[model samples]
Target: MSKKNRKFLATTVTAAAVAAVLAPSVSADELKFTDVSDTYADAVNFLVGNGITKGVEDTKFGTHQNITRVDAAVLVARALGFDENGKYKDAGFTDVPDRAKWAVNALVQNNVVDGLSTTKFGSYDNLTRGQTAKLLANAAKLPVNDGVTKTKFTDVNENFAKYVDALVREGVTKGKEETKFGANDAVKRGELALFLDRAKEHFGFFDLFVMHTNDTHAKADMGPKRATAVKELRSEHKNNLLVDAGDVFSGTLYFNEFQGAADLQMMNYMGYDAMTFGNHEFDLGSSEEGHKALASFVKNAKFPMLSANLDFSKDELFIGLQNNRYTSDYSNGIYDGIVVDVNGEEVGIFGLTTEETPTISSTGEVQFANYVEKAKEAVAAFEARGVDKIIALTHLGYNDSLNFDNDLELAKKVEGIDIIVGGHTHSELKDPVVSNEFDAPTIIVQAGTQSKYLGTLNAVFNEDGVVTSFGGELVKVGDFEADAKAEEILAPYKKKVDELMNQSTGVSTEVALDGGRDSNNEGNSSVRHNETNLGNLITDGMLATAKTINDKTTIAMQNGGGIRASIDEGDITVGEVMTVLPFGNALAIMELKGSEIKAALEHSVSADLRDDKTGLKESGAFLHVSGLKFEYDSSKPAGERVTKVEVSEGDKFVALDDAKTYFVATNTFTAAGGDGYDMFGKAYADGRVSEPGNVDYQMFIDYLNVLDKVAPAVEGRIVDVNPAAAKTVAE
Candidate 1:
């Protein structure tokens, strides 16, 4: 065969025996076109990549363009990669143009198709959908229905019935309407691609391996162990994707000292394929520098980050980094979704942060769209690009905040997602939890937080891109020995952290800082449901810090959940401070009406579940206040429990005016409505919240320095009016 004859289509195609690593498009070229609507993306990509034309232009498919009879023969003959049995010097038709003679003759000699007539090839006549289907059926040698002459489609005639049924049997065309085949309509360039692509046969099961992690936080010290696991997993599977779901941000002294720089370096060393934003990724957004650390992390990343529901357009720092398209040809940066090529098969991955980020963390101007809406859009986008096997890399938590959003809810709501790698709730799913029980399975997996485990999913997708079998497990990072290079990369960062961990902040204390919790649910603190000296000290520091930011700032409150651990009655070390306020919460000041304050104070004491021992309700939301006092009836209901509230002036306390507006300071968590503080949530939504970025621990340390001796006592600022509740506390 001459070079042009061989160019009829592509070289010999082989059936692929892939384990998650499927065959590539013939000639290994990336399909480049966008005008073709997503409705035809899969079929267009299939034939254009492997069978049909290489697009009308370099970047255009011109799907709406017309194709003549001779033109269709030329394409189908080439696309079929027909084996020529006839050495036709001419097609023996007078009207057949020399340019189309060889292709028409090739199809005729093979008995695959013929001209409209022997005298004329109808070179300029357009091909209809039925005619195209018959030609494709013959080219693919689809079995003719034996003696059967009817089709399920209403408009399909007896002549085209068998051909249309054959196409449908192969999952090719589903007709224009379910019951109607638009058999006589002109076959567009796109339809031609789809029919031909879907008509081709595929056999055998394909295997895929996905390695994922979520909520790893800044435990860079575990990098060596995780690196070992990652290397081992990738080495075992030729086709694999290594991804982190999110929260590679705050947790330890590493994040506190180096921000995200250290974690990014470790992630790069481990060769992360992709990552997504966690609510904590936006923790630095309220800082004075305004998401600078997070932005820098994205820019320096070796892999792309994804978030379909996140809109970084309003945040100038992330403007150019975000490519608002789902595509198979991806690059390093951020995108709504990406189709990664793994061992020849394409896998689509998108991301979603919890919509509560603005309330749960300091998310500044970066915005979040609805997850379900963006998720559907992502699935459609990937499908258009001919990619199945979609993975939703999410930080929405596992079955968390059900009233809002979570992985379980996401799995139930969205349809096409094959797997969900999630975090936020830090659930350790030992086995794969399957959703869409009645439909296609969506396997959900989450590794426990702080780099403790590496989640691995080995799944097999059948010909039609359906998961036939899957197994998943969380591989403990501690089980593996450290990788030499990982340790080498980690040494300097660990050394820096070690140097700071034990260092005294020069804040002397005569009494221990009581970051204490009552016995009920051991970590549940009295500082939560009532005032503690530690809460007072922290609140005093926050109030002081707020005053520095704004002189009018008077009241400061700290949530008990934000306080993690206690300090001893000795010299204060950097480590203890971090342990207590490890989340790196900044100061967020919001203006609230006195009515709203009373409502919030009500929520603070409204815990209905009382501790068996203390007879006090266990609540993480208990407020530790400075420059404020409140009395609440614990026996009363949630929204109406606060009896009286007062604000402190310089020398005297004044009853809180219900309509007066006041500036109150707290950690970013509460300011953003972290712990069911609806008033603050409303305040944040109303644009009354301002994050001054005062590091809470730093403020506490500064206050400790000013006090010369740290012996803070609870001063009865918050009192429960219930007599029995008071007696239980005394007991």
Candidate 2:
């Protein structure tokens, strides 16, 4: 057999043997045996839960009882998947009773133990330390020390010295005392339990449960549900870690009003271990009030905020915030990475935020570095500190191409990361994506956006920290019971949110203004794909608001992603409007050449949808426009997709003049290069754009107030010209 296979067999057999003897057969509630040490309670409970051993009587474990040869044989047999009914050739042993026949036969058949004289099995004899070591070493299939002549143990017989050495080499034992094996001493039940637990750990048979969430987006109401999950999971698994992969800010009226305070309270109450920063975390750092909101979030958070690549030293707002220069303490509030001990095992965890933060959000003076490089450095640092199990908590999207680092790329490039909890693309990964790019396995998982799902990834690793087995699933938070304490914490916040939600804007809609993208005109609606009345209403509001600043403002646009939710057919409230535009972006008016406008349009639909057999669909960058009409052919290349573009000239539509400049209105996020709008960002940087000092949602609210009974309809402002054709768009 190959060396790798041999090693695997050795560890597997050792784990099996240890697990069989020490695995728990009942719950802690049913464990009446009370002699276990407080420090080894979990270990002893594991033994009982796995059904490896049972109490000597109905309510007594006989912790001081001496183990016999037959007792050891029975445990080893059961661990190796053999039972009393398992068929095996009978070993002719005179002394082994019929009750011990199966165990003796199993041991003899498996070549783990033999009879004293090929005919007499000493089944009732008390098992000695050296004899037990020999049996365990043989059962584990450890390599024989054929060349060793010296004995490390003072009292171990020469015949059993090799077995004791093998046991020590495997970390299964270190002898009863420093230099003595106590070769002739009887093995006690407690000593046996300790040995089995150590062997199980040495072979990496222990459980590690990781509970994580991403893109929560200030759904503080779901805090109780998340807390319920964490509490239940922690009870079931002794080794558990709770972490968030960022985007804890924005998305609802709660965030708009409380500005992450409510979320921070809930997170602390739920006992979050660590969290990474998402782009939304920096969304409010540009203005003084916004900066204070972020500062408050950091100050109130009980857990560490991790960002290895971000340089916050230059940012004055973050003064005195603990930076993870060399420490791993979570109380510091800011850290690059941390080494946490879980059930006596060291777990190294680090964070990575997308480098696209500066262009996508208001990061102020904080700068970002390459995610891959930072990840490599973190891994090296952790490894230097003797940490093997590494987890990368990231806000990088699962898969995106805005020059932003993504989870899949990070997993493939960085070798040591065993798990990647990610967010930012709002992807709902039902199952973990396991990538074996290096020698070890890297698991990438993301829960769906908006606290809708909580992801749990349970993994089993070998001694070398390589993932040997793993399984994961997203748990629907709606199915879980909410914690009462969390609900009590959110009661005041909810009361304030309700007041905002109750205020009617008087713009009653007759239909569910479709913001959802239903590309084929099917019932499946999605704002990211097809045009809708809601998109029209939002863009028209921007255009009208911009016109108040500059009469020359002729067109307005908004990325579908910025539109968070759809308004139901009823009286709209300020809360609903806030939820729809929760990013708090201001209106930006810019002067761009007609050619640049067309280029922006081309960039909007540049996402490739042909691979999914859905032509020109489901791109968040899909533009919602007002005061302009355009048609694109999906079969054409990206830059050349826009075949016809027209601008409103009085009551007539005129073809766009390629060289003429026109004033356009959009959200500051889009105008400053959010959603890959490079041309718009450049124009703003070059003094070609001006801020109108109008909050995006306030502009919509104002427009709603102007038109008391608002009704918006799709008027063919944007059209898909090769609508029936299934073709690819050039990258």
RMSD of each: 17.0, 15.0
| TM-score of decoy 1 | 0.53
Q: Best candidate, TM-score-wise? A: 2
Q: Could you tell me the lDDT of residue 625 within candidate 1?
A: 92
Off by over 4 Å in 2: 1-202, 326-328, 504-535, 539-572, 575-731
TM-score of each: 0.53, 0.58
Tell me the spans in candidate 1 whose CA falls farther than 4 Å from its real position.
1-203, 402-404, 504-510, 514-532, 535-571, 578-709, 714-731
Write down the lDDT that model 2 would get: 0.76
The total of clashing pairs for model 1 equals 3
Number of backbone collisions per candidate, in order?
3, 19
Q: What C-alpha lDDT values do all the predictions have?
A: 0.76, 0.76
* Model 2 Cα lDDT, one tens digit per residue, 218-310: 788889888898888889767789999998887566887888999999999989889999887887876666467877788888888888998
